[model samples]
Target: MHRIAVLLVEPVVGFDATIAPTLFGAAADADGTPLYEVVTCGLSRAAVTTTNGFALLPAAGPEALATADTVVVPGTRYAPARSDGVLQPELAAALAAIRPGTRIVSICTGAFVLAAAGLLDGRPATTHWRFADDLRALHPEVRLDENVLFVDDGDVLTSAGLAAGIDLCLHIIRSDHGAAVANEVARYCVVPPWREGGQAQFIERHMPADPHASTAATRQWALDHLDEPLSIEQLAGHANMSERTFCRRFREETGQSPGGWVRSRRVERARELLETHDLPVDEVARRAGLGSGGNLRHHLRRGLGMSPSSYRKVFQGS
Candidate 1:
């Protein structure tokens, strides 16, 4: 089995530390055999206090890092990296114990640790959106894109916050095994398997608290009619609003234009068909309102960074 070691620095965010083992530990093959052996480790084989006032006794220490195929560093509140852009002495030594070529992952501000160790230099990375400015200020050399949920920089990966870590872990599973395995894990965890990493971390959703003010019904109708050609004017008419009012409200509610939202929904439908059905490309495109195979390929490539055939190949049986 692949061995995964979760390294927890002192004052660790308890929720962040549990995510790796909780997801990866639950992954299994068709025969119900565990795929990864996950262990929690600390600076020593002793108890460490969490930021939430609880103590956890780890099964191993820094020594486990050398044996791990993947090393995960969860967010920690007390790491020197947060303040000084440097690793603590013991933490640095512990990080040094990791074997070469081991996959490195950081959840939330744990990116701070990897950045401090210079592992994320010249690589795309992200942390919590709220901390993006601080991280950029501290480690200007790291290519920080705070808009996305996660960054997959080959051997090094970083996620935005506690929840985005789930997305990153699922992505790692998909990358390592395949979409089928990742989807299975996601199902077991009761979460969505594939949220494109490029999706915005913060959407400008102003809740339509007034029942009469919501464009929700019109949006749902548009989804139902995606196979039919949709137009902004038609959508505005459906919502009983003028074209200008509808466009403004749509952006405020969904953080996307009407046309953009329709396109995205069409792409999503196409993706689902590609992953779960055996239909031909053109048929899938027609069903998804993408018009033709060429159009489907264009949208998938531009929106998802892959072609229809490649996407199907990765997820057909998933």
Candidate 2:
């Protein structure tokens, strides 16, 4: 059995701890042989409280991590560790005890925990999009990528907030085993087998109560015409605003520009088409509105660091 350890901290987020077991635990070979043994541990044996209402009775302490092939850090409650970037003594010590060469994975603000322990320093990683600026300010040495759903920097991996954890977990399964097994796991978990890490993290903020107080309509229209050739001016015309005002409002409402949003949608469409169909690369490019396969390759390479064919072969299966 591959021993996987989940390190639960004080006020841990339930979703984070649940990720490993729900995905990797549920994973099985074609004959239903479980591929991984998951263990949840904390600083001590006491019941660990979660950000949610409940607490959990952990089966072990830091010792559970002693022989783990992988150690996972779930997101914790908002504290100085989250904002000011302080580390509790116990958490730091627990992290220090991790076996050498063991894979370390973080979910959402769990990146804060790894950063607090100095593990993320001088490494490329990411966390919840909302916290990217704060993480960057405190940990200047770390290479922060705000756009990715997760980052696989060899021994360490970090994922964006909430559901992106699923993407990272599925990615790990694919890397450790292969796409075929990972696809089975995804089917078991009701998730896509492969999600490009470069896929934009959906970081929408709550809009005002007044229906009139949103740019949602314009964004909706943009989505409807994602495959259409669009320019900033055309989007501005739809919003009934000048270029400068539209640009400002667009950024505030959507957290991205018209062009950036369109490009992201194109990439997402290409990824889906690549995985679900056997269309020629050129047709995939045409449907995704990337003009041609060469153009699609350029954008995919820029965002995902892989050629379209290479990406499809890796994730779409034989």
Candidate 3:
């Protein structure tokens, strides 16, 4: 079994700390056996208080990091990394216990810790949108993209606030095992099986001036007809609005233009088909509304950095 060490520092985000165990612990094998051994460790073998006014008595100490295959650092207000852009001596020492090449993850402001440790320098990363400016201001060496839900920088991963942590954890499971296993875990946890890391972190969702007017119906219609040729004009007509009005409302609700949103959804649908079905590339592309196998190949490569066959091989063990 893979060993996952959740390292908790003082004043940690209570919700962030629970995500690893909740999802990873729920992962099971074909026969329903656990696949990961998750343990919570503190800077020392002591009780750690959280920002929620509760305390956690960790099951292990920093020594656990020495043998962990993956180490997760949840957001914490107590880490000096959040402010002065450096890890506290104790925290630094505990992190140093982790063996080389151990996969590292950060949830929300937890990116600060990784950034302070120099683990994120010269790497693409992200944090809670609210703190993106501060993180960049403090650690310019870290290439931070605040728009996405998470950043999977090979061995080092960082996510936006709260729910995005769950997304990252599920993504890790998918990468380590397969989409089927990750989807099962997600079902058990009552969360969506997949939300691409490229999805926007923030969407301006103010109510339209006319309360009854919305692009929701049109968006749903587009999803149902992904295999059909969808254009902004058609979508605008369905929404009973001018093209300009539909475009503005779509961005407000979904944080993306119509063309971009359609392409992303098509790519996502293609990914699902690739992972869960055995259709030929041409057929998959047709079903995903990408016109042809070559189009599918181009979209998949551009969006996910992998070809259809490569993606299928990774997910379904084809």
Candidate 4:
């Protein structure tokens, strides 16, 4: 089993600290065999304080990092890293214990720690949007994309605030085991199975004074009708709004234009069909609203860098 060590620093965001262990621990093979060994550790055996009122007693100390196949640093309010962009000697030493080439991850403001240690230099990353400016000012060498929910730059991954940590954990599970295992874990945890890493971290929308004026219902309608051509005028008609109003409200609610959202959803639908059904590629493409196998291949390759057959083989393991 792969061993995952979650490294907690003082003043950690309690929510972020729990995400990895909770999600990874829930993952198991079809026979109910646990897939990963998750352990929590801190710099020392002492109780580690959290941003929340309570503290956590780690199962081990920094020495555990040496044996980990992956190391996760949860968000912390450690001033040296958060403010000065430098790791304190002890924290630096603790990180140094991690074996070289071990995959590293950060949740929320934990990106600060990784950036400070120079692990994120020249690497794409993200953190809590509220701190993106601070991170940029302190570490200009890092490619900070605060707009997305997370950044998966191969060996090093980082997520945005709070619940985004859950998304990143699910993403890791999916990458390691496959979408089926990740979906099972998500079902057990009662969270959404997937949220693309490129999705916006937050939608800046002013709630309409009349709630009935929202486009949420129309979005749901679009989802159900993904197999059919969904023109803006048709969607606007369903939402009982003019095309102009519908387009404005749709972008506000979803952070994407109507066409872009539909394309992404179609790709997602194609992926799901590819994974769960062994239908012919053209059939899957038609059901997903991509129109043809060639169209599906174009979108899948552009978005996921894989073809439909390749995706099915990877996720379905056949």
- Highest-lDDT candidate: 4
State model 4's lDDT: 0.91
Best by TM-score: 4
Question: In model 4, which runs have C-alpha deviations exceeding 4 angstroms?
Answer: none
Error of 3 at 250 (Å): 1.4
Cα lDDT tens digits, model 1, 172-277, are 8876666667889999999977666766677676676676677888988998998998888899999999999889888777656788778877887887778778
Worst 10 residues of 1 by lDDT: 194-203
Q: Model 4 reaches what TM-score against the true structure?
A: 0.93
lDDT of each: 0.86, 0.82, 0.90, 0.91
**How do the predictions measure up, each by TM-score?**
0.81, 0.69, 0.91, 0.93
- Minimal lDDT window, size 10, model 4: 201-210
State the displacement of the C-alpha of residue 34, model 4, in Å, after optimal TM-score superposition: 2.3
lDDT of 4 by residue, 38-153 (tens): 99999998999999999999999999999999999999999999889999899899888888899999999999999999999999999999999999999999999999999999
After superposing candidate 3, which stretches have Cα over 4 Å from the reference?
A: 206-211
RMSD of each: 3.3, 5.3, 2.2, 1.9
